[model samples]
Target: MTLGAVAVLASVLAVSCAGVVLLTEQALTADLDQAAALRARDVASLLPAGRLGTTVPGAGEESSFVQVIGPADQVVSASANVTGQGPVIPAPKDARQVTVTLDSSPLGSEPLRIVAVPVHLPSGPGWIYVGTSLVQLRTTMSTLILLFTTGLPLLMLIVAWTVWRTLGRALRPMEAIRAEASQIGHSDLARRVPVPPHNDEVGRLATTMNAMLDRLEASSRRQEQFIGDASHELRSPLTALRTQVGVALAHPDPEHTRDLLATIDQQTQRMAALIDSMLYLARTNRSPPGSLTDVDLDDLVLEEARRLRSIGGLRIHTAALAAARVRGSTVDLSRMLRNLGDNAHNHADSTITVALTTDNTTAELRIADDGSGIPPGDRERVFERFTRLDQARARSSSGGGTGLGLAIAQQIAHAHAGTITIDDGDRCRGAVFIIRLPLSAHHGP
Candidate 1:
């Protein structure tokens, strides 16, 4: 990059300096030509005064000289500097003015800028030639050319050096980030790249990268914990099934064998349910969300209420069900609603209220049970996998169910780009799981 910048700058400078030299040459030559024309006019004025052969003042100092020629193109008179030279330039017939440059003049070896003008001399119509030396103009132009030839390269070198150093300094942080990122592994996610103090682009990039690393590390830790908990939960049913099988094998009683088989089936079902929940969590959390369709949330709420009513015992009140349409995976939404309803069923005493309502932007679903509410401290913890609370809030069931219902519900809600939270504003006798999902764009009254 630095080299390219220098090359571009050099090209521009070369073109500009060449233009300057050309313009300077034209300007200096124009001035010299004008001076020679004036000098020839003054010398012509002297011819009618009959002083054509007199020595001219200031004309001898430099190689400047004057001459007069007869109409027949013969040398008539000359300046002191070129007294014996024939007419340096031939005379013209008409009284027209002209200018020329002579490389080798009669006065000296230096070039001359000369102007010839017709004059009415005392002898007849003749021409006056006035000239000035070109040594000074040539010297000035040579010095300028020399300066540009040497100085332009020096300027380019300086520019290249400055650009190289500035770019290196700016990219130094990115190099450090690359090195740090390369060394990071799954085993060591705690390390972070160095952040420069300046609040520039590099600093912002480093900050963003570190933020991503922080999220990755937190996710990794959570995954490890989830694996450990899942292993422990699965082992419980396996241990029970193994012991029950061993007892049945050792005794072989017909009546107890039936019960043993039932127990084994129950443990196996529990293991299956746990594995299914884990798989669901993995799929929902690890992958992108699936294709979504508009689902009537009110229908799902009424369905859950109907299911609970069929179960008997508890009074399910869904009087607040309103027409709310949302966009989500229908099967996943159904499973989420079912898990919440099951959680309410497992904990409710005499009543469960399932409510659905909507506003301009979101649909809110609240499922509250009349059993003892979760403590304020454990409200968030209830969403964690296999979390157990006190006897009143512990998620227990006759089917040896895995305590993954709330976790599954929360994951499903998140997959729909929604939120599920236990309502802290409810000061009543039950936990209220309030889920807010974004309304579909086409939702209407």
Candidate 2:
């Protein structure tokens, strides 16, 4: 049951119980007061005023003990109950008077409720007193109290039961939602937690949870597809190399076998390098750094460019260097420069230039290769995993290229809260890759 319903029921029951008790007490008191007043009136009407009529019938010669007194202080008649108890009641000094119980009795339980009136007749004026005990009043009130006490709790119980049942029924949508959620799996992300067509908090919660599930399912499906594509792409070269080796091994001739063996060796090297590149990308995805730290990007870029030059494959040059500080892994920075250098060597007219600089809040590394420039639209997506220029595949030599190199470089940059983009080179005629990294993060990696 919801807390709101329970609270409402408790408040209602409390107020009702309190009201019943108060109203009952006031009403019972009023009834008793009215009954007592009537009894007093009857007693005053029956009194006598003259000695012939004013004398109380039970009064004996001991007049002081039970006689009624007139206005002249003459003895008339007396009440046994009133006169028996000494000075049981004060002599009436006014016409309108009140009675006081003379002695204790069972009647005291519902004591006297009366008013005495002065009597006047041809003989003289005197006083008569009357009262009614509170016994009948008590019995009426007790019955009321008993009924209220017994009935009130039953009412509260009914209220509590109604609160629990109604609240549980109102929240029945949650049960359906739970059932739907329990059946949904990573494979069946298309399913959604059902939400009722109601503008309420529970409905809103169901909608929000369903939206979150949709996004998670989409991300999971994308990751699965990415792994499958990577596997297929990696297997192609492996299968070709294996077939080539089997062919060469079958043909045993001195010079021909040597040539075939060398071809096998080269293909084996490319295959191993591709596997390594795939592994590097997989690691970056698996363990992304929480932050990027201080790195000397200029030195890192210069070092990787020189290493590419070691193979004596491309004319690599650099802009006059400066201390370019950035928040990124040194290894990742070098990997980005080396991949750009290798890409340039693959297609350039043999020239590569590396540049580095820092702007407010953004530090950048730019590598330019005098290669056939990437088309404007394709430049953005080339860094996606396994994507390559359609032209690069048909070329006989590939400068040790694996399609994942640029993709790996992009992943590493993003892990550092940075980006890698391709732009127009020095003369705006060849591919230029620029990496941008954010600065001033206040926490650790």
**Residue 263 displacement (Å), model 2:** 2.1
lDDT of 1 by residue, 210-324 (tens): 9999999999999999999999988988898888888888878998877888877877877888888888888878785577899998988888789888989899988888899
Clashes of each: 0, 8
TM-score, per-candidate, Cα-based: 0.88, 0.65
Q: 422 in model 2: Cα distance from truth in Å? A: 3.4
- Evaluated at residue 296, the lDDT of candidate 2 is 69
lDDT tens digits, residues 195-245, model 2?
A: 988968889989998989978987787678778876876677678777877
How good is model 2 by TM-score? Answer: 0.65
Worst ten in a row by lDDT for model 1: 391-400
Candidate 1, after superposition: displacement of residue 200 in Å? 2.3
